[model samples]
Target chain A: MNPKNHTPLIFTLLGGLILLFIVSPLLGMFLATTPAQLFETSKDPEVVKSIWLTLWVSFAATMIFAIGAIPLSYFLARTKFRFKGIINGIVDLPIVIPHSAAGIAILGFVSRDSVLGKIGSSLGLNFVGHPAGIAIAMAFVSIPFLINAARDGFENVPVRLEKAALNLGASPIRVFFTISLPLAWKNVLSGLIMMFARGLSEFGAVIIIAYHPMITPILIFERFGAFGLKYARPVSVVFIVVCLVFFVLLRSLAKERKSHDA
Target chain B: MMLKLNNISIKLGDFQLKNIDLELERGDYYVLLGKSGVGKTVLLEIIAGLIKLDSGKIILNNIDITHEKIQKRKVGIVFQDYSVFPHLSVKQNIAYPLKGKKLTHQQIESLIHEYAELTNITHLLNRGTQKLSGGELQRVALARMLVTKPECLLLDEPLASLDVQLKGDLRNLLRKINQKGTTILHVTHDYEEAIALSNKVAVMHDGEIIQKGFTKEVFQKPANEFVANFTGIKNFFFAEFSPINIARINGKIEIHVSNHDQIKNGKIIIRGEEIIISENHIDSSATNNFKGKIIQIIPYFSNFELIVDIGIEISVVISEDSLFKFKFKENSEAWVSFKSSAIKIIP
Candidate 1:
């Protein structure tokens, strides 16, 4: 090997940049609040309720995405059809739009002036200031991550495998469950984690949709406005910790899946 | 015949399987010979009911199974990739088709053991099927098919991905599979495989089975120019019967034609096997002998494919021993021979 080979230097530079970019803000968040302060804020009754609502709604939204998007993603990946490009573009539109813009668009559908909102109110159910609103907002912006990841996973499955399964006396549905789904499960799982994380951090969309019953992000925002950074930083620290733990567990799972596949 | 196809047709975006008619006798091996993109695999899938026909009927044991679902069709498929389930063990993969059946666990286990033994992969039962080599994977795949006891096995380039030694071994394995009362509809673009494995061969071109017959009939008399060329028939050139049978370009050589069955307005064919490469025109034994210079010398396994540049480039295949003895090489002078009877004068 050449002593002057540039690979290690290049890799070190890239690795250092990514480490600094991700770690610095997270470190700041952690350092901003002491463990004593984090524990003290956990006793705030309002803060506890908002965080509970946020986690549950985000979890529900993520579960719904898993249930619906996996099959539909496989379809988009495997099918050869006219207007597939248009359909794919439509699926990815939420990701391309800013979260605030996505919220504004959702507002157009569920505002009191809109037909759906009128029908909802007539039925004695309201999207505004409800868990349903939070779920919808989380789902709208984050659904594409799960769908696209799952789609790419399904795409990597050779069509010949399906044909082989069919030839081996399995139906099309049987083939999907047995071969296609299992092979693509890792990518789908990673997508689910990413989508869940995306949903957890959804501030712009959820705030615009349902501002009163403040989610964790909205609570942090409210705390900052009402009680200043001293009150908000502790909750932010706890929220970051929860998000970090969830992600770390998921990251390990994803890593295990990658190694298993390899 | 266990399976018979009548004018089966299916069209993918660019490729079409047009008017393919085939008959597969009980335990018969029929190889679909074609170029890479000539819809050979598509036709096999259509027959297996994985692909719906544009306009056709597939008859299996006299039941019109044109609209049958793939699982209901009882066709086993081994793709070029073998398509073994990566997650499933060898036993599980082989025993996959038996999952929803009425067979007991022990029965399925014993069946897997039996087929595994037949394919000589019994030792790999607990290992994942993906860990097996190409030949091993194919054997397992074939064994998986065998357990289902399919009406016919559809193999698309079964040994195309294997090494030369493995391909030969797998070919033998495939031959053994065909012997075990299973009909095979094997597809390959390789002429040697088609010749070796198939009792009947279908030469496809541009999505159509242009010529199909018993292996010898199709090889001896290809129906058209495309089939002739595709199968290494090595026969070509313009000729007329009225002019005492002279090739269009070679005025120095003359040939006699009985013209028993003249086809109208087409180039005549002289099969490579029929063309004889000799040292000289020793007159007393054979006719249609002529002097020529070798243009190309291609070693074709058991023989040498000597191209005689007699104005029209007549390619003659001779034994390797003869090539070594005479040293008939590239750009060397040589004598060529063929009987007028062997000159397939296209009518």
Candidate 2:
């Protein structure tokens, strides 16, 4: 061990403390709930329904909003325009504001008295206490992760590569599809995963918007408040396990795609 | 003219290119030479339609392409860094521009192989670009651009990033490409590359084309002092001309120069290789001769640059054989001689 190596070791020790701080509580909860309890919670119809709703709603929000977000991110990366800094700040606003405040702001925009609410009412689609409202809240709170990641991905691509493609007689749109998008896909995938995971774990805004069709997070809170920690622990363990399996699966898929592209 | 830049001018925030004009004939290998940051690459980008021109018309093959889209301009450019797509195989990168041209898959494949063979990268066609050497990457970039069969090819400092042997090989390749009837505009700051690869040359300074002509003519007679210095002429002095073709340098020495347009005052340039050194005065057709002591001798490539104090320090390059034949050494007295026609007068 060299004297110069001591600083990195010290930093590693500090980092390990925070890592343990995060893992210990999750590990303790998993150990406290037995397999029998986890199986029972998984078999409960309400529990299963909430988990399904949570997964599908968040996935739907991520997929639907990504179409618009990806193009906006590309524009933000490549073009120069007035107030670009302000637009970038607005994109990151959702990540910094409190979730309850975000929910209130969304409610004010989509309430029955608002113009959009009136338009939805005309279409017989109620946003309050609806799955639509749940999706909107999840999208609002989690979209920043996707935008920032995709923007960074686009920024990392060398501008000269795109210029070379154009000089070789490819159209601008063709260059974007064949050159820019493929090079930046890895970061885009990571962003998609982050957005989906963040949306799945959302509770504050989703509860305010639509509590009838309970997501797993809201259900866990409800069970803890009513029947104490014992009842809530089983559901929490099941949810965490499911989320972990999906996260691992998505990350491996991203890695495989990256290697294949390379 | 196959291509012409008609009074092109562009402004790019704090740096501006002003009123640049150039013309190239068909099958011409033109070299644009300049120091770094003289807008050489920016000018190449404008020709390739990657940069917008604030004012000027770019006429290529008698068609105005000033407002044309890049894809429609029929021009290709190979950048200094190669910019080979990291996510694509060498073959796939070569085939990129051919994908949407309504060519059959077999046709595209055949074209890719043809260009790959031309650039001597046929073995590396299916390989990914991550681990290729710099020379291999350059070949890949060349094949990708050449496969498109562009009307004109623009190379931006193509040889600046290669080793000496690689530079020679690529210079030969560029010559072969030009001989096969592809017009090329190569941008480099290397005079050797300019002399080896281009029949015509243009020197750029401070965002303007200062001088352009046949390579031999431009090297022998530059338009100004900057061009003379840039072309590697080491002997320069301010001189006042008399009516009898005599130039007096700082009232120290007088040398005869070929008369030109009765110019009153001008700068005199002498190539180091044209000046000769001898142990004693020799009888010859040479007009100007002086006795001077050698002040310093700096070894150049296979030769020595002798700085002789003939009233004014003048640099002279001589072969090793000549150095020993004259018995030249530091602080040794010798006679220096040159013809009157050897001096270049830039007014």
Candidate 3:
């Protein structure tokens, strides 16, 4: 029986290998930065401002995803639509497309000449070299995480609940808010958490649009390019720490939302 | 009270509802009876305003609500699966419709309690509905639907998923609801259920209502062969017209018929379970008696249905008590007798 546990043994080996692969870089970042240098860099105002900007921008993007992405995801989940398979494929396109390509596509549309950008500019909003640019970049790469997550959550919900509400003389919209949203809230929350975390780590796209906003990822890149990995190491370690806390919280939430077999 | 559907036609995939016309008066418990994929549930949904009909007019209470949205229609529906919300507890689920109304928490609670006690699931008020058994969930679902007190209620096979034993109790509960002027449009495919509960039955096949009338009338005198076959009327045959009312099976054999109501394009129905069989001809004045050979004896619980050949194979069902009393073996000669009233004309 002990020897027969090869499946679990194989699983353990695979998990251990993946953990090493993810943790080794963070370990190297910490090793590259001495304690004095890490403490010295942490005192800098530029570092603090960049961290706050990254945190707040990610939070704003997550809120936006919650407002817009949730309804779309729920619609995709609940309805038997003609283009549902295609719609889902399109939502997932951002995840698979090269992040640089995604950055270029978003840049082309929000470049003040396109209809959407023109409207935004008329409303005294500009995407170029502003927080809006970083927001758009983060949104482009990370909204798929939120939509797919919320969609999966809505899909997990039993549609009978919606029907029950309607048959009880409640309106369709009433049923959606009262039953569907609350039931699938945890899934959406996890999506938001992941999208926020993904937004925090975004670098490739943000560089194309708003490098001066100096999101934490850009700061990490700038420091490494100008000074060395030694200077960049401390910032990388700090970003890693902030992201780890959120990652743990997301994992816990996912666990909480999972159905127990009973 | 007056619910009328005028020429309702809807195409859903291959099964299309050609033109269904039905009316349910106040205090009428109408059950839509049909086989699978006959558009019975779809019809219920259309009436409830859940599904938009391709073309039709649904006039409820003299209101032309053909274009009304689902919420504005004010009709309640209990889907075939009961479709209870798993997230909301019984109390909350029952209170779902009451929300956004002028009712307070206490008022909602009282309504929930009132409907809950009526459905006899008051003890399940606080439990998550996902854990409920099919019967309990159905009661909660019913309680929720009744709490709203919509103009008309549509039920789609509330007993289909329950075990055979539970159907009787659920059916009786449903009958009591029907008795209270709910004007239920119940949908079911089961024949016995329609016989047991329906004041009016609309027979649907391949998405069209072939026959609709008083329950017993439709069962006793089917309008067509399809309906006759549907309602378990087993003794069906066609014979050419004769000068006398004797349907001649052969040169020497003929069966007597007197009821002209039993003639329709020269086709008639005799229920398999209604005909009686005996070894020697009985002295009773049963209108039709014929000498026949038993082709098969099919056992059905406490009785056996015997198929006999008197030129044409005619089935006669006999009780097991009669099976023992008459010592007739299979392939033996027997005389089959039935009354004229038992024969029904099928258009």
Off-target runs (Cα >4 Å) in candidate 2 are: A1-20, A107-130, A259-262, B239-266, B272-283, B287-337
Best by lDDT: 2
Clashes of each: 3, 0, 0
Model 2: clashing residue pairs? Answer: none
Order of quality (TM-score): 2, 3, 1
lDDT of 2 at B173: 88
DockQ, all candidates in order: 0.59, 0.75, 0.47
Please write out the lDDT profile of model 1 over residues A26-97, one tens digit for every residue.
788788778889888888888788778877898899997678889889999998899999989998999888
TM-score of chain A of 1: 0.88
Ranking by DockQ: 2, 1, 3
Instruction: Provide the lowest-lDDT 10-residue window in model 3 chain B.
Output: B243-252
What is the Å distance of residue B7 in model 1 from its true position?
Answer: 2.8
Instruction: Estimate how well candidate 3 is docked, as a DockQ score.
Output: 0.47
Compose the digit string of candidate 3's lDDT tens values, residues B73-168: 778888778777766787888887899889988898889898998898889898888779999988988888888887888889988999866787
Q: Give the Cα error of residue B161 in candidate 1, in Å.
A: 3.8
